[model samples]
Target: MSFNLSTLLMTIITSIIVIVIAIAGTRRLTTGVPKGMQNVLEWLVDFVYGIIGSTIGLKKGANFIFLALTLIMFIFVGNMLGLPMNFITVHDEPFSIFGIDIVTQQMINESEIIENGHKVVDVAWWKSPTADANVTLAMSVSIIILSQIFSIKYLGFKGYVKHYFEPHFLFFPLHIIEDFSKTLTLGFRLYGNIFAGEVLIGVILLMGMAGIVPLAIWQGFSIFVGFIQAYVFTILSMVYISQKISH
Candidate 1:
């Protein structure tokens, strides 16, 4: 299946909706005695804050908890949302939205066509939004940017520079390299895990429709792995922020 800009946009919109709903659902519950979904969410919040507070300080850790929660919830939900087998592939079609013209898909003589304002072509819907390299890299870049921003804001220019040359000046290049590696690892880790999970689902589909048996197994594992990856990403972000803010 082929994915288009519209589908990507829809996926992002839905992801935002999921995050907002999650936040609102758990926001007002009493903190002392969490229950139901609030219990699970509070546990996640406390766990993340605990890591940050232990590594950095209580105040900064509490401040960064919202950012951590946002990233974790968004990515986790986005990855799991891919498992639902509910979507369609059709030709790109031109349509109007809010009086503004846009192109998507349309039916053409029992076949799907993608309208390019002037013409349409058959397109297939194949994978989840997170499976796209662009989306993964964009997320990575965003996290990296946040790291820099936090560093600059908390550490100042001199302190930020000092971060790259820790221990001694002789080891500056190695330290710089090591610091940059986190960004690369963070991006690729999420991309690799999500993409591999997606590919496994595709393999199951190819085996046969009766492949429903294995689909459940793959999807279940996908959810678990997705949560792990999200946690890793959030924790790393907190770690980076703490490292920056510490010095």
Candidate 2:
């Protein structure tokens, strides 16, 4: 539901590092046949463009390609963060960074206790931000807001308002509810998938008692899940935008 402070902090830190690497790679671009980071970035850009073009049409989707790419990259990166790191809990009171305690200890279990009674319980340093409903909801709602703006721009204010009453004025309430439901589903779907994945990985890790084989298998699967979720979210956003903007 709410973000773990450590998770949020980790998300920000990871995002910054990704951005820096991207910038560094991009700045060194050369004209003749891309290599290394340039090759990877180009491929990613082309992949996103292909998705956008297929979903929203090449012409209209061009306007939104960058948004789609950014969303996929950010979400994928956030999801990937929880895969490698582990966290511990300090249970005497709560763990705090700079005088603020962010970890919700209630959500953690006794099984997570590694050593030294309740005074300190070690856990992972960060969780995937997409696992938190608040983060996903914010992302989905922002997309909805942007969709509305595009709808108005393309349809004019009167046309945008009339969209709610399509077929009959009686359908307006249903349409409103549909909009809310879209946001809810979009947000919760990502949160649910990622959160469930994290929890499953944790449980597996515990059961395996730090076994390499199980950890490797689950982490590999988790990476695949993360990429698929990112793609699904991006394509859905493009579809939503296209629906709103197209006549």
Candidate 3:
């Protein structure tokens, strides 16, 4: 009944569908030239590969196809997950996962609820996974860890530490801090933009059917946002790896 609970339910169902599609497509790709869904999936994979290879160099990009594909598919599905709801419901209720405490939706007024006891929370129908800070932070941390792994493999311990200091002694701390800040910003920036877009969509829907006028507009804008976010995520990951491996 709570907003979080509803969001979780929708997200879970959406994720299952995405996973199933991915698995089916993956299995199909191993046998022969891709066809149907497999064809589409392969095209997506190739597109991601092209972008990554061009930006990071073929050797580095080929190694990163796994991360690139995961990000692109996850984000694409997350963005499209909430597209199919005729009526959206919102309510103030408690949420528990496997009997563990999580969060509850707090309602300020009774006027928000309909006769069915469902409160029409603004934009109650769709939620974006990338809109969550935890998801983005988790992804950013993964990229940082992978970069460090590459650094350790390519550069010996001495090189790793020395590279951070760069051309001067005075700027060492600043360089280290900048590296740390990049990880932080990568997470927060993606979360903020995607979440803002999600919220904006909700607001537009609340403005009435005329709001539907802008639905097409926002959908077009969202496609751009989705592609940009995916590219940014991949670019930052590649940049980190390149920085680590560079002399």
Candidate 4:
């Protein structure tokens, strides 16, 4: 399996940024009017809290507040990382990072990537982590699995199984398919949007000076798309968890 170095590096960077913001935003306690970062953060927390409360219920959803907040923040930040620019490099031969061969000599010799009649490796050194299918898929899958565990914890293994047969036994197959479809669509939706945005950005950049106006417009739209994806993913995840755990 091929691994994406850019995805890893960018994910780490996104996580760091999110963690730093969390720490900085809450370092001081405020009983009065929130200011600056704290104000922004409190509003965000209430926004997420209301979404979860609407889905599962404030009583049941209280446990998931932190989870929902973290997911939304990390994903939103991760999606925004690629808006301004991307860092890419070309390697004529094998390449490595941290002593690990990311682009091996064997792959280079066998690669079909050609530019100007020369075989070479093009690597993205930085971009949004959510732009990668694997990254989004892993996040989706993990959230699904976590929901299942919570289902079991709340409903017991017998209830979990029984719910699959719900409203009837014949629904078993459909329930199985529903979970599979949810996982696939959830992951693909985020990846497709971000990756497409990045691809269009690259295309516009090829237009030279003429791209300036449209590029500016597209990036502004991309920022909106990124934030919406993050919010959608978080809210849907809470809904899925509620389906399982609140039955």
Candidate 5:
């Protein structure tokens, strides 16, 4: 399979953005008073704390605040990446970066139309990481696995295994399916929303000068949707983790 440079690029950019925000928010630690970025950081941290506390209880939730904070920030920023702008590379030949083949000659030949002697094909070079199902599903599966690990840590090996048979052992198969379902729903829910938003933006842009107003309106709405998706993903993850441990 050909590597998706856009997805990998967006993922790296998202990670760097999140890291920069973290450092900028906490660069100057002070006890006297909070000002500037410190205040913003405190508010964001408190928001995540509220989420964790409500879902898992404050005492137990303290440990997961870092994880939750990272998820919300990374996801929110990632969802917004493809909104205001996108870069498309018009490829007429094979392309690669850093020794990894991104677009191969065979791909270009198969995809490009041989019109006269010119080959033409377009590939998106930038987009939100969350816009790709591969990235979102990976995140979902990882979270589910981590939640199971948490269940084991809190409930011990026997309790963790027993969680599936809760209420009755006959439900074991149902519980297993439930885990897989959670992964699909959680991943696709975010993916569908973000990807649809991008597709709409692309359509609007096709209108050229006529799309300015609608594009602006939709971009505003898309930003709001991005934040909501990030929040929902974070909250659902915490819910999954807490519910497993509670059981």
Candidate 6:
């Protein structure tokens, strides 16, 4: 998939927002009672921990809680970025900066529209990073690689290789294919859901341009979908990791 500059900018902005929230949330962390951001942070931590404990077993899951939290938070924030933003399209007429002409161009979800016999460029901002296959596949590949590393750490090189031949030598290819399938499915599942959600929201906004009701409803639902996808991705990652490391 192509990497759009707009997507990169949104990703960076999402990361910064998450970092700021984390820092602010923990700055006044108190042992006695949590309040404000700390309370929200604690709730999220507990929720993630519970998911880990249920899926991968509490003892083994503890080792990967930080990774799980990071994945969920990043994905969730990225998924939510597009919900409240509006897309803007600038006319192809060149704007000058320091006497240099810069033509306006569309980035992600670009569409062409003719106005008064002239074609104008449309640009979408703050598109979800998870909506991009490249970002999702990268995350999936990272998780798969980490799973293999954990498998080797616990199972040794010989044992790791031997996992492919379990049950019979004929099953080796199937086991190898399973690894590739896991990566593909994990990546596409997340990308498809988030991308579809964004497209739907865009359609709703366009259709209901004169009214705020449709946009308001879809935004709320999209936020819920974003959180659910984050949890699903994280839990599935934990499951894959547990499977690899299990004897």
RMSD of model 1 against the true structure: 5.7
What are the runs in model 3 whose C-alpha is more than 4 Å off? 1-18, 30-34, 83-89, 92-99, 102-126
lDDT of 4 at 20: 91
Ten contiguous residues with the weakest lDDT in model 4: 103-112
Q: List ranges where model 4 is wrong by over 4 Å.
A: 104-112, 115-117
Tell me the tens digit of each residue's lDDT in model 5 across 160-200. 99999988999999999999999999999999999999999
Better of 1 and 5 by lDDT: 5
**Per-residue lDDT of candidate 2, residues 134-170 (tens digit):** 7899999999999999999989999889888988999
- Superposed by TM-score, candidate 3 places the C-alpha of residue 20 at a distance from the truth, in angstroms, of 2.9
lDDT tens per residue, model 1, 1-247: 3335644774676577667767766778885777677877777777877766766677767778778778887778777766876354443454455755433333233344334554454433434556656676777778777777888888898898888777888889997776678777887888788878876886788888789989988898898998898888888877877777786
Best by TM-score: 4
Residue 241, candidate 2: C-alpha displacement in angstroms? 1.1
Better of 3 and 4 by lDDT: 4
Model 2 collision count: 10
For model 4, name the residue pairs that clash: none
lDDT of 4 by residue, 1-247 (tens): 6666667889999999999999878998699988988888999999998998889999988999999999999999999999888887777756676878886444465443877876678677778999988899999999999999999999999999999999899999999999999999999999999999999999999999999999999999999999999999999999999999976
Global lDDT of each candidate: 0.71, 0.82, 0.70, 0.89, 0.90, 0.83
lDDT of 6 by residue, 1-247 (tens): 3345566778898899899989989998799889999999999999999988888888877889889989999999999887877556475543444654333343412466667877666656558888878789999999999999999998899989888899899999999999999999999999999999888877777776664887788789989999999999999999999888888
Clashing pairs in 2: 86-124, 87-123, 87-124, 87-125, 88-122, 88-123, 88-124, 89-121, 89-122, 89-123
Query: How does candidate 1 score on lDDT?
Result: 0.71
Q: Which scores better on TM-score, 3 or 5? A: 5
Superposition-based RMSD of candidate 2 using all C-alpha atoms, in angstroms: 3.2
